[model samples]
Target: MPKITSLAEPTQLHERILVIDILRGFALLGILLVNFTGAEIARTGRLDDEVRRLLDFLISSKFYTTFSFLFGLGFALQLLRARQRESRIVPVYLRRMVALYLIGLFHAILIWNGDVLLYYAAMGFLLILFRSLPQKLLLAFVILSLAFEFWTSLPSSPSMKISGLLPSRYTPEMEQQKELDRTLDYEKSREAWQNHTLSTRSGTYVEAVKARFQVWITGRDFLWSYFWATAFAMFLLGLYAGKKGIFHDLVRRQRLLRWTMWTTLPFAFSLNLISAYGPYVLGRFYQQIPDWGFSLLYVLAGPLGSLFYVSALLLLFVKSERWMRRLSFLRWVGRMPLSIYLMQSIIGTMVYYGYGLGMYSRLSYLVGLLLTLAVFALQIPLSRWWLSRFQFGPFEWLWRSLTYGKPQPVLVRRVRPAEPT
Candidate 1:
């Protein structure tokens, strides 16, 4: 029988990959930056076009893509460990996914509109379904998903034609009109929110729930399938990485890492630059043209950039003790990602929403950026402190208990009785 290492033991560093945790923590910084900016924009009105362009290029989808990749990698690693321990992994994993879905549902309905946990939970089930496939087959699915996204970006794609039944929501002409209506509605909602008169502020819990559903329903795009497809593609790549043990020994694999870094970095940067800027610099008429090129860059360059980053970090971890010491803080945050992620949403809403500080309309991008940094800084020390006393974060403990249909350990140590007093 294989020996089982307890994650509850903080000193057993060999059981966990510090680099992966560091990357996850780094991803959180980017995620919060984008999310905070989005919230600030909704609250205070839009940002300047130039600033918007910059954010689109730099901060838009990159971090979330990294996060999704890590999730897939983690899944593969978990399955491997289960096999090592001769355990039934599938049922346990599915239960965990379900628990995540429930948590996500509550977060979406009660806390935030931009919640991705539900989406992650949903996609995680698909990951399980595809986990046993051959590596080549997995790569093929990734390619197919990217192709689908590219095809959908074409203006002549049949999406609109299929949506003809829903004229008000689907038709391009109607969509344009709806955009205006949405802006006006949002302005009014913001005013209400600022005054603490929104359903979420002054009304009953049911009213707030209803409001949340309404927000989700209206915001869901027909292109949602494409989004999921893209996310699944990243998951597949992450699985491949885990299977190959790409992150196993960075120092020994310097040649491989260097090749990937040099090969991917240049194209990723150039492609993303073109994708972000081509619409404006080329012409306004170019904006009306097919965006397949942009989508292509996003699918191809985005992952390449993500991989390049991973390579860079692995190298740093292997070569620089000083950097490792500094980045070790991220390990704490990354270890309890779910707890930190949910905490961000709760704190963010309270800081910005009407029922709390009502500072949503007062935020600027600069202020939002500062706030993001501050929250992450707080979370680092907070996560370390919590882990010091507990076997897991509160939510993680609950999730594991539910997943295994039994109570899991929570506290790090047990009380000892005095003998022969």
Candidate 2:
């Protein structure tokens, strides 16, 4: 074990992983693109359809998987550090989660209903339960979690039939009632969507807040039902990688990464391709594919695609200095991911909300894409400049301060000259 340092100290600059930051920076771009296009006021027309399809194939689910894995890896690193320092991990980690939850709560309630930080914080607590499991047991847990997610994502017909075998008898009246319920649910969902769009685009700040709260409430079921398992699985995968030290020496792991990347590339591409365009293509030849089928495709594709992306990035960084320099800006953004992420939401809301330019649903996907790129391009230089003078981003400093129960120095203090000795 390494010698203990101050337990409260954050990871020092020299001890940081350059590749992780770069990968995070890259993931942020994808996340921004998805969020921007997804938030558009309108999503109709051939051009929009094409763009959406492209995004679905190329970006959807991939970046979040990466982020989730990174989160787990980060936790593993923290655990390792704690072990080295002979410190108990639970109290400090628990405080961090609580602080994160509070921050996410504020972001969701006041800024945007689509906030993911709150969900991440909730999952972090669950992660603590598996932290001490042996590597094999941890791997088993990840596999089982992903398997459960895939099973649940399978078409509902089989499960529905199995469920029908219970005490309740199927009847014509029951079928009629079920149909009615389905219709009512569809109408309710459509009405809610319309209300949300209108409120965000034109309503007052208070009205928007109310609408956001309602949307967040309504989304809780879906979030828990669909996302929780897959996200946790990715987190475990990251932990697995961290424990195995897969990322500690990219140079030594080059051959393994190359093999994994090449092996997974075909499946990732094929699965995502089918998920993106299969419905339209297969619909012509057979019955329409169920929504669950596409969802399953995504579940399978997400990790594979993310793995390929990470491996490719690592290889590129390790083998090519030119590429590394070009991508170095991502490190700045990665270093302060929390601040950048929240800033994205704030900027996005300001641009789309009623009190701002009110362009919520009015922009085309292409325009939104351009705007995402523009905003991120601007953020790169801004982050670089900020990091040059500060030890952490504003929000990062706050989170760290809260987690450690003390203020962390934000500015870079230059070396002081010795007085007359």
Candidate 3:
């Protein structure tokens, strides 16, 4: 097994960490595809389709699941390092999670109300128990958590109508119309409508933060269930990969990558159609069996799809370093994921919040997607440039400083390695 090591070591990050940045940067960029859905809903009251849902369908196939799987991969890396040091993983891991949760809490308010970091942090650290488990057992745990998510509080049937724990009471036609009015503001509500896209991205930070807390505390039925479990699973899986030195040994990693590729590639290719039709069959025809089947398939498919996504990246990491250079911007965002993720929420909320520009319900899916891309495009390059000058991203520096309960060196090679902690 590859011996564990310190993620907090004050050494300058070398080439080994580059692939992670590349993958994370790519994942971060892709996650925006789905984030557009939430951004739009925050501004307007519709899912104005024709293009947005199509984009969502394209993204939902693998993006979020890839993010989740990578979470497991990272956790595994942390645990393995702690073990090698003969250190207790919980204290360090929990500290990291606490900081993440705090960031998440703040992000939910001043940005997008749908921030997942706090939930990921709160539930993220709990994967410690599964750390030492064999792959089969670790996978089983993942399966159970997803099953629970699938079967839990779902509307049960088309007649039952409710989808999740807090399904909307709106009618089908009304819902359809609401979606149409999203981008086509000049429609029926044109007279009463006001477009507020420009300033909302950062203007309503205070109120947005306040509203987020209320939503977290008050939404009893909507309390997050599987977020922690999923994140934990991903973390432990990462740990396993790290122990095997998956990142270091390209050949061995490539073999595993191949296995995932064969399995998930077929599914990924066909996933868009499956996801789109699965829901339509459920809602339009009460095809409960297929609906339930598809839901189950989604959770499993998510991981499988995520695996393929990783495999594709591995190919690029090994075979296409030149192409990778063009995306160096993504690596910056990946390096400072904690900061960028929260910033995304902040930006989204300001754009849509009632106190700001209030463009939440107005942005069409297509427009929302464009906005997500624009924000990420701006973020990726800036993040990379910032890290080139500093040891950590701004939020990362604060998190490390607070985590160690002392000021951490923010400049490269500035802090002397203190005698073995």
Candidate 4:
């Protein structure tokens, strides 16, 4: 929540915690991979089902969880810094959250329907409410939240089964009618989607926006408590990590990191493997809904995998200069996360939409993967260049400016040599 005034450049502030930036940068790349996968699944049948499965097993849910954790960590760190400066934290923080929500709304309605920013902004507000709770209480809340999520998502618990059986059995005619209705519904939904795709491909900006908003509205779940609870739980875990200084010094935490990596990763991999390939191996029932066991396994494994990834990456950053140098470009993208995130939506849509390149259904998974890497690789240099001349990423600057009710400086100052004395 600290304002980036002209007195101290925003670019310089990041120097103190380069690891967070690097982790953020790493998360961005993973995000692109999953986004591309989702885009492929939405518009076209999986180009390579194997690739999709591999991504599911390794990448799908991990990075977003990482981002959520980092968001919470950022909140805690910002609050501490605010206190140090004797600043009123809530006012600035509230403004920042509002700005984030606005930007997320713009992105979700106008650019991409897959936006997570709005959800993040909303959860961020809840995080503010609980930030002052004792650490033990926060951890307890986190566990309860995750448990709540798992409970809500249960395909059919005993209580649900009992309630479900209480409904009278449908008559033969009614059952037949229900089947017909479901068939008709599927056809209607499919037609709507086709039209939506057409609009996105060749429509004007207004048409595209309308199409996105319609799709999101049609698919929105007002009662999706499980997902919301899971997200908040991740945020709380992040708060706990920040409070514990787990990420403050990778070297000092090496043993903890190793223990996490060694202990959690194998089970994480095993659970995900089952989740990803269970249907093929076990039976079709494994693929059916209300398989609470598999769902719980998946939900539990995701955070563990995410933690393993973070610990491994931190160890690499602290131990190997070569790996650190290779991954340094991530810092550039990480620093301007808002800019880069929106940029991905804009560029990705332009590349795949009918109006731009119209490569949506045409692209194979391999091509999509290549495109993902290419776009991110291009962003690395561009972000570095932008940050070199500007104090903040464009959106970050705007958000900070709006939060403080004033314009923040963007361009770097050019120092002139002193005249000979």
Candidate 5:
């Protein structure tokens, strides 16, 4: 193996895919909508319920899966570049993950407990181990992982418990104790949520930080048991797509793209519909889906919906120049997603938290949705103007610099005429 000194450089503008950027920009919009209105807003009336239902069916879970897939695709691209340059990928990639993890820690601790970056950073290490796997094996792993996720999501499946891992000598007494412990855990979690809500809504910055930290700690079980697995599966899927060079020539792969888009749409729509309103709809027939069933549907819909979204966008880019131009505004936001994502959090906290506008738990779902759109609309032009003058977004520059152990050139230096010889 080569020395760690040989590392690949950052991707240049000419090498970027426009469709990927546009898709990322679109995902960011969905993420913003979900994040801003999520659990913070008050649900007061039918209007709020309807809006929440719509958002659940259309936006929730889909965008983050897309983002995770993109992260994997990006890793594949970096690996390819490293191989091309005959450079070692481990050193540079590890540094990148470390930097991302630190940033995520800052965001999660001081900013918001809902941060996903830390999870992504943790998964990045796992993804590195699979970088050298064959494409068939990679795809197989993704399918199996997703299948296992679905299996675990079924109501009939045995719920995971620490008692299950004990020796065969486990008796009825152990079962009773486990049940008692589960009840206690639930009550504790409920109390934690109350604290989180109160602090986030009206407490000082220090109080909010403590509350956020507590939330993060309590949420670890869900993060480890389900979220990370599905996210990693998406990462592998993206890596598979990248390794196959599918995005390199969308025109050549138009038929496949169309097939994927159309095939996934029915599943995405139907599953999401059931996940969102299965109780009401099925009750008419004197039947009802279990909570676990809804969870299963919601998890299954994420990747399917994300695939439909990406394929639809790629097809539009390939077939219609007009739509491409219309969506070109999103390109800027896509180009600097890190900055825009963090900015959304910062702005959202200020608008909702006690320290700023103090509107937490006050806005209705419709109002929150509208505010999300307005803020993202402003971000489009701001991102464009900022990127026009600089090589990268502020956070992106900082990330790159930290990864390389040196400051990267931020300004887009102009090429002046050659000096007279």
Candidate 6:
């Protein structure tokens, strides 16, 4: 751990944990690697087709799962935090989810329909039913649920091929496009999802159905489903770790850390890396894996890798002043994640959509990541500067205000401690 020589008396913000901000920082950076692509390609672009399957595979196949996995971790942290607060956990959690659901509803309609917050909020409701179950049973529920998803999600013909071969396409603009639309039907919707065109406007009814299902039914299943299969499991495991105070209890922490590293390093270096590389190597042979199989990998791989990353980051934060200072900006961006997520969605849409810069399918995945970094880099400084003078980013301010039904203090400043020594 970094020496606390500078603080001599650094204030404790929480009774026990500050890992939420740190973990969220890592997740925020990790998630944008994919969301930027979707926003850049689909929301912004008016392109007839998106042919970058390899890039999509990398982002969708790997990064988004990582994002979802970390989201579970964050959720687990929230629950753990509530336990510490001695507050009404259920009502607080429910209220928070309701707020998120409302935000997600507005977000999907005005912005991107592929929002995950709605699913998360919906899933929050389902997971409640199992909150009282024994840990072993809770885990079993996760496994069986995932198995069902995999079994239900059997492989089908490639969506692109199905769509490309179709004779019926309907766009108000082109006869050529109507021919394209005919081929996408009959095949499972999943294919179309993997290779769907950005500019392809479904009639209002189709968009509405997608919104309803994704926001309600499918979203709920996926949220709790992933929660149990990935985050909740890690959370239970983390809860165990926290309850034991692994770091404070060095021998136990060392043992846990050693095992965690030994188990996860190979996945980071091998499994995830391979999963990232598989589409390129396997080419057309890289049909998607079953959801259950993917879930198992997520539990085994993504969380493990995330653990390793978290451990490294934590130890670094504790021990290295320069490293912590350098990362302070990223940590700031993480703190205002709500604002950043929506901002990226909005700006990214404008850039690709007809409304703004209109950059769509034209950018490659690698370039999109670079572009994401550029945007994040801007936010790091901006957030730092903003937070230096304010308590919350603008959107965060509103979320806090709505959730608490009171305007949160916005600016941060050097001030006397609230409590007496």
Best by lDDT: 5
Local accuracy of candidate 6 as per-residue lDDT tens digits, 196-230: 22332322334544544444432333333343334
Those runs of model 6 whose alpha carbons end farther than 4 Å from true positions after fitting are 1-19, 38-85, 129-252, 279-304, 315-322, 413-421
**Which candidate would rank higher by TM-score, 3 or 5?**
5
> What CA RMSD would you report for each candidate?
6.3, 4.1, 9.3, 5.7, 3.4, 10.4
Q: What is the alpha-carbon lDDT for the whole of candidate 5? A: 0.86
Candidate scoring better on TM-score of 2 and 4? 2
Per-residue accuracy of model 1 over 174-206 as CA lDDT, tens digit each: 787766775775565555343333664455556
Error of 2 at 92 (Å): 0.4
Candidates 3 and 4, the one with greater TM-score = 4
Whole-structure CA lDDT of model 2: 0.83
Ordered list by lDDT, greatest first: 5, 2, 4, 1, 3, 6
* Candidate 2 residue lDDT tens string, 128-208: 988888899988998898877787777663222233346777699997886676566556655665677788888998988
**Candidate that would win on TM-score:** 5
Per-prediction TM-score to the true structure, in the order listed = 0.81, 0.88, 0.76, 0.84, 0.91, 0.66
Candidate 1 stretches with Cα past 4 Å from truth are 5-14, 42-54, 160-207, 216-223, 275-290, 414-421
Q: What lDDT does each candidate get?
A: 0.74, 0.83, 0.63, 0.78, 0.86, 0.55
Error of 6 at 290 (Å): 11
* Cα-lDDT of candidate 3: 0.63
Steric overlap count per candidate: 0, 1, 25, 3, 0, 19
TM-score of candidate 2 against the unseen true structure: 0.88
- Please write out the lDDT profile of model 3 over residues 299-364, one tens digit for every residue: 555566667778877876677778678656577788988778767766765566666567756776
Instruction: Please tell me which model should have the higher TM-score, number 1 or number 3.
Output: 1
- Which prediction has more favorable lDDT, 2 or 5? 5
Q: How do all the candidates rank in terms of TM-score, highest first?
A: 5, 2, 4, 1, 3, 6
